[model samples]
Target: MLNFLKKNIALAWAKRHVSQTENFKNNAEKLQEELLLSLVKTAEKTLFGRSHQFEDIKTIKEFQDKVKINDYEDLKPYIEKVKRGQRSILWPETPEYFAKTSGTTSGSKYIPISKEGMPFQVKGAQSALFHYIAKKNNADFVNGKMIFLQGSPELEEVFGIKTGRLSGIVAHHIPNYLQKNRLPSWETNLIEDWETKVDKIVEETEHENMTLISGIPPWLVMYFEKLTEKHSKKIKQLFPNLQLIVTGGVNYEPYKDKMEFLLGGKVDIVQTFPASEGFFAFQDDYTKDGLLLLTNHGIFYEFIPLEQYGKPDTERLTLKDVELNKDYALILTTNSGLWAYSIGDVVRFTDKNPHRILVSGRTKHFTSAFGEHVIAFEVEEALKSTVLKYPAKITEFHLAPRVNAESELPYHEWFIEFEEEPANLNLFKEELDFQLRNRNSYYDDLISGNILQQLKISKLRKNAFNEYAKSQGKLGGQNKIPRLANDRKLADLLEIYKL
Candidate 1:
């Protein structure tokens, strides 16, 4: 019965709302007004009148002017208010769930997600599913059991509510009705604690014919590797009808080839850009280049020119005014009671009306050593091309800058775990170095002496990084193996790169 509902409800919504969905492409002004109205209404009730994060800004423009541009740093005050159990700033009463996100340190962010926000997540996730079904015209496979690799609670209290991170909060919303109807008999609790659920999730997902899978790229990669090691043939044997594999949370380019290898064949893949703040976008179809924003749902959109958003000067733009194909940083006013919130991801629209955008990278993940700026996506592309040249099976890797004191050039060090041992590791480095330079000429020029000198490869024991993450209490559901690090600080725990 639930499978019947899962298959039919989404299609019914799409059919009845075909014209509305079409409005996504035809009318940008109408879409923006609807979103703005939702934002202002939610804001008036939650902020201005209630929440303290926003005060004294009676009009939308005034609120936009006074709030300033925000990153996570800007959210601290609001989070603290929530921590103090003050309902005066955002919403009334304690939010039911908090989504946790980890940064470089143990300073995990606890973003409050209300019950109101849950519907957006549910529907946002559904968009990826429905889009796939609509494109493939395959409702049979859509009715199958799905697996979501998710984080467990690290601590019981976050933002003054008994909460964890967004992944766990999302886990809580997996409707009981769906669980009863769709989950296989083979599921297990991967999250033993908040810090140690990644490994346990890998252990649990093996051999299951995962019809649908969603999680961060890092965690999915680790899970795929483990699944391939023990149950590679079994994966195809058991899940012959497997239809879709969805992943997000980080850039997907680095692992795309390897993910295809792990699944034993090509499978429909959908990428999503979702933060603890709100549902941003989902891949429009299996073949589209960008994600379609959930324009009429969840949150209202605002874009500050990427340059202007962080700058002290320029004003932000509303959905109606954003330029096409230009980079912009997003500020959101959400139904979850977060107002004029800066979620800190950078996005660019590929299409104007239907509102398709590519998530370029995070604001923090850029590399600027020697002023040879390389974004995470660039680094990911370089690594993918580099890895493709070698016969070695790259189990895992972390890329970081190693500054040479004598020459002043910053070389790249790749700490990799390989299945096949290579005779001369320097060969791997030379090829990788060549590719990096070709991809980014600045990377090439810097390599002679004043730039990067060489690329270094370090081999790790199988699952060594996974074991290390387990030690740090990060093993289990949805924790990804750290693929790249900007600095050498975390390198000491990882295996050293060989010349």
Candidate 2:
């Protein structure tokens, strides 16, 4: 009875919170303008501010003119100063925490979470649940055990400020009300080895009335696999009460069929778009295809059209200026002291009134070896299209251009690890190729012009991608397989795992 009452209270609060967003969405432009000015004014006296003249950022256009789009390399110096305990380097007051993330060149990058900015990160996640609860008119999941497969919550200090992976950092902030319902004991969560931690998690919650599970799709698939294996039963058979799943980090299309098959019953799905930088958006309606972009989340957003991304004097458009369906590289100026930061992700707006979006691809993660410029969204959708007809289950996959195929024409090489291999591999490949061509005209032109061969698929052994990630010291915890690479580095590395 108490649990039921608690759920009703949560539902009421969620409905209210969701209702509040209607006004924010209606006045998003005005709100975003105010947010940017507020951020600039707060940081104006800081080191980066003083240099960039943030005090003169009285208008949005002026702010953009003063602060050029900046990548991580551009802000490294100021970040290093913050790491060494410099006060007011980027924003007033030292950051309360630094979210550590793996970097390609910098080894590790520490993103600040100001005392003020941290709530938005926490609330963004909460609001996602609120959206779900309000839309579905149910919060019964709040009464059951919920688990978020994530990084270890243990923290290390960087100059007296706590530092850890974004997931780990967020784990510490799970609300007091939800504490009892949250699963995986603190000791198990502290286990660093993802393989070992998953085992412990399975043992701890296999019999619980697990109603909600949240994590990236790949890792959640891993957990579900382990759970089903241990109990020798499907998810529905094991946890009959399980009702909700929240997933993020990657597109759910490729894994959707497999995940549903594993579940073996009906369960509501919620998608989210979160990063170390911030929680950007989440699925507002179960019926909608895209996530509702958080306009009031203390992050001012800018979009650079993908075609003009790398060129000099690129145009940056705000939400008011963006068009539907066209891909744009996302940029952000945040209260966390990240100014004009290039977030590297590409997004396509799906709606204008409520400003919903789909994460299309990464700015850097693409295959343009033959000038086709195939993005992650294209490849994932292609595979999804094929899977719908072929009926195969994918564990994971990666795409790379095989430029130096000695005996064959240079082609896109897809290394796919399938949970269940299709009976007709050749037909599946052809369909996938066809789907890709349909989605990307450039790829079709290249194939027709004899510049490239039809793309090739290299089947991978079960758990090949998992093992590869483990070998690379990135088996889990926000590490995702490279969906597309222009070069052969990842392709060469994955060659040995091919079946």
Candidate 3:
């Protein structure tokens, strides 16, 4: 009964606060204080356990004063220690689950999130739906089967027990309060699990009354392309109730047009920021970006300047110190027992107090091919702008930088697949190249023969991403082709069919 009352009180507080954006903004100081108080409790449990690491209030103040910034790489060993049931200088208790990342850039990163931490992630996702419904003035559509296209559900056993990947693990923990009888099953793969079920997992949603679809942008885009090719006319004949699509994990620019084509019209779309570690944020309204902060119900936050990310001299700042439009690397001390932990994402504040943010990119996910210094968001924007000039027929594209042996500079290469041929293909590529070079100074210098050579375009095979994903042992779920490759090794493989 006490737990229920506590949950209700928190929910009521959230409802009251979120309903008034102005209130949230104005009360930023109070919110920061409250967040710090809660964080101190979490920190005390972890850092100053029964033996009392802090010992006195003065030491606690000193600890806060001297807090250091950290990254996921820094937290891995601590997480492992906690997983083994050892109390660390941070977490007072052991973590319950280890969530697995997509492993898109490198090997998968496993994040330890506790049962207490899970509620925040789940509530944040659901609140986005509420926000969407409020925006649409259609609260009636809140209950339905939300098709989540995630990884295969194969659990690798550790210590003689069975456990699935992060997505699967989270799905298994979904509370009964939010579930519907008709909820969309995790259909990426059910058998053979993660390691081997790539081919066996099917992409058919023919019979399901899918009301909302959520997954990584790439797999969703590929799935929509296949739907248009195989069951274009018969879509209404299959899932007649399909309504909204929620996508994240990667950029959405390339697949926006193709997705609408398959849906037969512009279906309402919501983007989200859910890592294997947590469901961080969501595009509450049909906005171009997202509204975000830590769930008030769970995690606590600290910030460090973006420029200070890899530097050893970086000092951590509390929420009180943050400024709007400035980039900050996040330091999280969570209910799950992670302290001063950096999740590796770089973000900037979009609004103050009410606390909305936009994820810029990972600190490492950049293209400096010949000093171009192109970030992921820049590349996504360039492609989005280029696609706007073309007919709505173009579906998807991927960009990479290729180094030529004969030329002095590296070139920007694009692989595009369209629904129909453009009126003038050469004009399209030329304009795209011009715009990209003009928008980014680095690219312009390259084009001026000061640095890099030229830009190239490639026409991918129809459903090239699908075939590529299949070849990589991926099912039609959240995983998709990378939009930008930062280095020469990955870029060479992407330049095969130059247009």
**RMSD, one per candidate, in order:** 4.1, 1.1, 5.4
For residues 211-249, could you state the per-residue lDDT of candidate 2 as single tens digits?
Answer: 999999988888999988887899999999999999999
**Residue-level lDDT tens digits of model 3 in 1-499:** 6545544544554465458545544665566556555655556645433234433323324545544555666566665555455664455555566666556444666576666777667776776765665566543233445566556466665432334566666676566644663243454446433323322222445445666777776656545545555555634445566667777766565567666666665467877777766677777546546455644645566677866777876767665678887767766666666656777666777766457777766666666667776655666666667667865366555667776546455677767766686788787777777777766786787678756656766787665655555666664544545556676554465455334
The runs of at least 3 residues in candidate 1 whose Cα sits more than 4 Å from the true structure, single-residue gaps closed, are: 1-19, 28-30, 45-62, 92-94, 103-106, 153-160, 184-187, 190-210, 231-234, 304-309, 314-328, 387-392, 419-431, 438-449, 477-486, 495-499
User: By TM-score, how accurate is candidate 1?
Assistant: 0.82
Strongest candidate by TM-score: 2
TM per candidate: 0.82, 0.98, 0.81
Report the lDDT of model 1 for residue 335.
Answer: 71
Model 3 steric clash pairs:
154-193
Candidate 2: TM-score? 0.98
> Which is the better candidate, 2 or 3, if ranked by lDDT?
2
